[model samples]
Target: MSNLPENSFFESLKAEDLSGVAYKNHLLKKKVLNYFSNFGNSTIQDLSKALNISTPKMGQIILELTENGVVQDYGKVDSSVGRRPNQYGLNASSAFFVGIEVKKEYINLGLTDFKNQLLKFLPHIPYNLDNTEEALDELCKIINQQIDKFNVPKSKIIGIGINLSGRINYKTGYSYSYFNFSENPLSKVFRTKTGFPTFLENDSRAMAFGEFKGGGIVKEEKNVLFINVGYGIGMGIMINGELVYGKSGFSGEIGHIPLFENEIICHCGKKGCLETEASGRALISKFYKKLQEGSQSTLSHRIKSENDLKLNDIINAALNDDVLAIELIDEIGKKLGRGISALLHLYNPELVIIGGSLAKTGDYLFLPIKMAINKYSLSLVSNDSKIVLSELGEKAGALGACQLVRKRLLQSE
Candidate 1:
């Protein structure tokens, strides 16, 4: 029932159906594959030391893996006084995964191999989110184009992983906030249309998986939180090393939480939401509101229309000591801190990650956040959690989706 198998081998195959010999073979093969993936072209001793097993044992696993075509020999590495040992690596080209990030205005598609290398990525393909059928058609078209561009056999692709904006039910594969399909679930429809197995996840949850697997400081830490401040605000929670999906699979909708009792309505049919105050949209809105009132700003000449205004314009201006830009970002950071304070008191997470576009502002954004949290939250709770900016930028959701596909494939195998 566990999604992340720490040992890598225990969940490789079905326990009830596997004989002793068969299960042992599966375990060794999985171990060898995992070792080779982490260290490309590793020798028997290299794998042995990493896995804390004997060289002979590693050699046995490598031989079995190589014979079964899961691994391939990469010549020999000299052992100084001793004879050379053959190095091995996974058959990276044997399997491929497709990950898609779907948004209101655009979609991003990425392809990764068994080695978890992002081989190809197509960014910002425009589409309309409200039209379910048209959206599905566009998705299929883009996927086919990429598949043709890569010239990959359809059979070799393991599965397609999709991460989208909105609330999703893990059990039923339905997104309540978007893609209100009347006939079938998005996953089922996508799978039927594409003729490939598919997995769907909340965009924030997918991004958190990317951080959990590589980006954030979650190594050996159990509780973590990933807050995405893109055009809008979103959050993903990880507790006890597992992504939290509450009863309805919608636990981390922090942006919609009404932090202030104002008339500013949110897109989610709510008033005074945190996102309306602290999100990138809010930042832009605030800046424009001041500009319209004839407020002096260095960005006035550079920005032609509201369309030309982006977060980077504000961030660059702030970095150049522009008081207005810095002030706006600082205000947003304080709001973010308030939201984070609530999370700290509730979850008491070990690490909290700020990701997405606004996170690119780095310390300018973080300093104010730290100050706000310190002022609002209990020292005991705030001191326990360390907040850091996410290393993975826009690629988090797509990469995490592909990684999830790889994980499912490994468990099924």
Candidate 2:
């Protein structure tokens, strides 16, 4: 594939390599882009007033941007007094982004335009997460294949964001969990392999970004927690309108917190972890063990072995009113509530989003979670938080990945 547009303002924005008047101009152009990104169409007068630039200077930048095909005239703004001014907005086709969500069992890839609209979504590509070079190569290969399917020009595709589970230092582009054998940062390796600027993000945090920016659930709320109850429980924390990435970029590992007294071994090789009792893995384990002990369910005949069972199977069973499935999901929800109660005390988030496959169980899961939160946490603290399911659903991770790429390129002082 061809590389990103050479020596173009888009490339300069990514490189951040300019100085003196050129740098000031670049910053000004970026400010206009950012303004359009955040607030949509704007008149030259509106942009100049909002960005505190003179109308003549703003008009010059807008004209240059229009010539460069980065910004387009979006027609006249609605008005009743005197003449209506022409509005300008981002040219959605001017650039594209690719987002990949890597899971233990499958991968989700999505293509988004400059407008943050998902153009294509390809989910459940059979792939296993592992710590190996071949696995990483396979991932890149799949990414190339999926992007090829979209048929967007290589130069038009600005960057690729890949979301992985486990400890990821996004600033330095290093993943401690997978592909750590290489001396180079994983992001650099991906950039080299895929021939596009590549960024790495933690899956949960990326999902949180997706919700915060595009899920339409958050309007003015600044503090929120996204509970990712997938194969394992993970959390994406937002504080003061920013995603929290602690030292070493491993902040949101809420699953590893030892909140239980159980002897069950977690995937992290620890005992009494929240994941040991409350995650999808834990639910599946409990369900399988119950079946082995002669417990009956509607899915018993359908599932001949534990390996044949899927999270969707349990969700569908609960939706069909299977007693065993409902009971198990409720139990997991209660444990999850106990875990979230601690977060409420600590973060006091304005919203708590329940996400992942188990979240599909809806009220069968949320009702017990609410009950347990009311029972364990202080009323004052828990009352401040509103828990809801993710609006972006299974697509949040991929969509968030695309948004992160945009954020990195467009971030300004």
Candidate 3:
């Protein structure tokens, strides 16, 4: 084993010396760390079998990782063998990750250990996306509060990861779509305020990463499309285990994909975009229109203000068998399905995951989306793909944001 310092991981990335024997050692350690991170607790034999490496090689990797403070011996597994093998798991205290999800109405802050387990989650913090100063202050306060709770050393906190619902340049850490900052860069501002490295990623991409890492999407099935339906619809595409960021990291802007010939202009100033017909905002808007048009429904009696009608409220009404709510969501689901069909034609992904706020509708959302796919998509592509609801629910974005930090900052370091 080399006498390299434990900080070599971070130093190597910053110094750009991740080559030769050091690189190989890094890869081996990362593999071991990833396995333990995924499986929780496992023995050297278990790792060898899982990775198809010889016991001796696996032992060497494990020993090196243990020495580097990346892996820790948890205890012995009670096996009916001569002696129970010692189990190993990631040292969660070794590193920390901070993730923030920026939404229209609020911002969410989360703290996770290197293993991606949630240490703390601060949801629905009052953050007006248009208010730069107030939003920044609120964000900083919540992050500092969480950090204090964890009692982690500043050095252990690798970086802050941010997930937003608009175009973001992950490489430059600049958000061209959401948030307003002049003179000072957002990432630099956050880093200076918090004393940690920072990263910014699109919310959909972050959700896809979360699903890929922990949401039961197998590593071998690398190509996946995650569709997020919230205030608006968006997509995150992963091809060959890498995010399909187009020329400007906006490759998966499926929400703006034209699905209808109608003349409703989208937020992107386009007509007939899928989001104008399928998103939660679209559904709620249409529901209000119908209500005002004297459409008979239980919702009309309950909704005093158009703004009072939330996506979850509509879903609940639909679940309770409200005729108008059910019909409205069913229509939205069908529109979503049509958008997904277009996605199938373009990406031909192995899996299509429906995520975000509307995911709570479950079968009400999925069944109709599936029906639309069956109606619109080609048999070959639809047959090869599986459309499933996200298992992580609303936490996918925050979890994925944390994962972005791990992938970009911690692991590379």
Candidate 4:
């Protein structure tokens, strides 16, 4: 522990041993802990078979985790065998984590247990970039308030995870693309303001982390891609179960990927980026443009203002059989699919998860995206990859943020 870095819990875990035997034992323990943590209580045979390990080895790892207070034995399971197997589960009360998802308009915050359950969810607070100090102060106050409300002890709170929509240096907890304040380092500022260790990550990457930890996608496959479509589009790439943040921590800026050969300007100061043609903003812009041109649609009469055209509005209208909204979403979905097709060719990920606000459109969005992939992507790649909507939905980022802290705690132990 003395040799490990003070700022990282996982570093301490890694510092324990460098030998092959020790490494294998650590991995075995991790596998067992992860299985129980995710699948709830299970018997030794259940875990051994699920993890493809022998009963003796699995028992040894379970014993180690139990010693570390990471796992607890409940009672004996009445099985038709020589003896009843003891049931084991992760200690849900072992620790807690704070998750924060930062958007341009507001910040979503929540407190989660080791099982990633949202013990407390706070209302979204409007974020003002101009008043950085005030914003940070308010954020800290809310976090403290939530912790107090939950009656969680300070020692049990491992760290705070902040998810943002920009390039982030995960190692340094610095966001270069967003939060460009001069005097304060956002991570340090928040940590100082709240007195909690903090971890920062890209919003889409956080979504990926949440989805990965939440389960469903194949575990053996390492390459996974998450496409987040909201006011804008972003992507998170996980290769070998690790986030692929290229040089400068901006690897998954898929929205800025030049797709269309047009002159529509993007928020990133570029023209013809995928977001300009396919994002929620793009859909809203297109809707407004159509309305101005006197296009006949129910939305034209329903939406009095541009801001009134929410992603949910479009989705609901479409679900209610609004021809105009359906048509608009369909067009945007096609563009989004084309963008995803590019990802398929580039990454060849085993699973591609679509998440964010617009994902509520559900089948309306998935169909067009799949169609576009079929049309544009190589047949082999398209055949090998599966595209599905995220199960965590809007809470993915926040949940993933909490998982970050949980992972840090586990790694440190």
Candidate 5:
């Protein structure tokens, strides 16, 4: 179906190379956009070398693409000894994909092109995790409205990527948590409800993909591990530049690891799980219990009821140096760090990223995390992994969902 010229060498893409529906027939155009999508900004000479064509021929194709609004002038790059060459980039308007990250409190929506350019963003849309139909109804409404506003045909949107917290079987696309959707695969339900091809992934794994490619760090490294600390702690492991989902897609359940021997129970019915002692939910519960036991604080008056308390409230309290809040967070950090050290011993990744809501606590969390790693991690691999905070903030999961569709469309396998 390619619009490639009769003499063109580019043939049909292999069947295994496609995950979602193909959008266009311009093989050369697809290749050009794929090049920019993978390598970011580049000059005509660079495209020529990748495509194995003369610069003049590349220029001619680029001129056609620019005139059609598919390519744009990125800017001029100064040459070492001559006139500067113009750099080119993909026009953001040419195509787009949908990414959605579902949290218990709200949902984040994003739109991006093949170049991984985020054309629009929407955050903090209220959603109730208990009612799947109501949530899906509202989600479709929002996505349809955005597509109409952008004037892109639904057919051109390669897919919609869904990232959520839960035990997800990627092959079956069912979750053992949040909406659990036993009647059909969650992605199938989403696809049927929205009329877009759908891909589903764990939230932490999705964020790892986004940071790996869209965060602009994929080029220099081949191994990474992302530890997401939120309502629960989850791990996303990447080895040799590819994400490892493990057998049955439930590999990174770090929160369920029995790191403590205490009597506390986890929501998953496991006793003494890491999440029972270290998760954000655990932090808030511990803080509230202390308050109930007559511990005084400046926050006591502000929080008239337990219903008004949230993880953000505790983090804000800590930022203001509330002694009680700091103590609780430090405890959570130590428990979290113990789990991280276990990962360090098992994976030996080059970089370990701390992401999700708690990552915003900055050094308050890292100090304890590093201390625990130093005390328990094997010296051979602990020093090899560099632990740092995620720069993508709360949007990491949403953007990572977008990366799923982009990678699928381009077949980055």
Candidate 6:
């Protein structure tokens, strides 16, 4: 394999191929890279102390990383005393990770550097998402096209993370909800077609990871629940600072929770799922029904047909203080809050983040959720959880996908 960090130290590459010493060194190098990724620039002594390695050994690893163009010298740290220690950090150009979010109506693509900083984000690429072979093919084609247009070489693209909805076993690289036409894993197909190491993640989990690492949560907040109120409601649960993936890696199916009494059948073919009333799809359905009932809204004419309407249009309308838009969002929020009350009773998370497309409605959505939580949940449990909107908003899923690639790559065996 090439000595470049992009090619040599990928997660797909087997560490068993390396000798014991080489494997240990590889593990240490990965630790160093992750340190730089999390803490940004650091002095050699600081790295040695934090990573629990001797200064000389740390120096050796740093030297190897620098030689491989993975770590770059960032001159000396500021100090009052003479002979300040030199700072080192990841070479931003060393490798790139791509994150792709496949939504019901469109795709979001993003690129992150070795430091896990988003370098580019392509939102709203028109594509229909479905559980069909042709849909998967078109998705792969769009991903490849987007990557090709990026100002990075194919070899330098170390990994790709594709986020999809429904039951996805990220470890097994299988998407149970979509692209299950063949026995082959969805990620395997993507890897073959995209010519890169690819991994599949649940969209809600990806969004939660994005918020956990990039946008939301302080260092103190470890337990979090990210409620993804997208086309369908999904959840990403974090407990004790680690994302919770159940035995089958299908942990966060909060949307399908049987919380309502309505006869509306969910996309999952169940009746009275939380998603039947508390999701973006639900929001659109309610808006259309209300419009047909002669409810007035400034956006009614703009949405002549169901196909012409979009989640964003409603969110934007709510943001502009449209009454009907706000009312429907509040209704969704109340139902979502009731569902979240159940989660709070179970998880007692330190934080609950409202994310996805509906998050754009802001206080129009947040206040009702807060009210509902207060009304439904026990004060002690609900009080511990801070309900807030997502800081990353629409970008969370794609950005989290990129973060997941780096995370899986550096995970110790």
What is the TM-score of candidate 4? 0.78
Candidate 2 per-residue C-alpha lDDT over 1-413 given as tens digits, one digit per residue, 9 for 90 to 100: 43789756677766545789988988899899999988999999999999999999999999989988899998987888989899999999999999999988789998999999999889999887888889989998988888788878888899999998889999999998889878999999999889899999999999999999984688889999999988888889999989999888999899999998889999889999999999988888889888989899998997778888877788888999999999999999999999999999999999999987788899989999999999999999998999888888878999999999987888777
Cα-based lDDT at residue 72, candidate 4? 83
Every candidate's CA RMSD: 6.2, 2.0, 5.0, 5.6, 5.6, 2.7
Inter-residue clash pairs, candidate 4? 9-412, 10-411, 10-412
Quick one: best lDDT, which candidate?
Answer: 2
Better of 1 and 5 by TM-score: 5
What do the candidate models score in CA lDDT, each in turn?
A: 0.78, 0.90, 0.80, 0.78, 0.78, 0.87
The C-alpha stretches of model 2 lying farther than 4 A from their native spots are: 298-310
Per-residue lDDT, model 2, residue 25, is: 88
- lDDT by residue (142-197, candidate 6, tens digit) is 98889889998777788899999999999889888899877888888888888888
TM-score of 3: 0.81
**Between candidates 1 and 2, the lDDT winner:** 2
Q: 127-167, model 4: which lDDT tens digit per residue?
A: 54333656656667766666667677666676789887867
Task: Please provide TM-scores, in order, for all candidate models, with all chains considered together.
Answer: 0.76, 0.94, 0.81, 0.78, 0.80, 0.91
For every model shown, the clashing-pair count is 0, 0, 2, 3, 0, 0
Candidate 4 CA-lDDT value: 0.78
Write down the lDDT that model 6 would get. 0.87
Assess the local accuracy of residue 360 in candidate 5 as a C-alpha lDDT between 0 and 100.
Answer: 82
Model 4 residue 162 distance off true place after TM-score fit, in angstroms: 1.2
Candidate 5: residue pairs that collide:
none
- Order of all candidates by TM-score, from best down to worst? 2, 6, 3, 5, 4, 1
Best by TM-score: 2
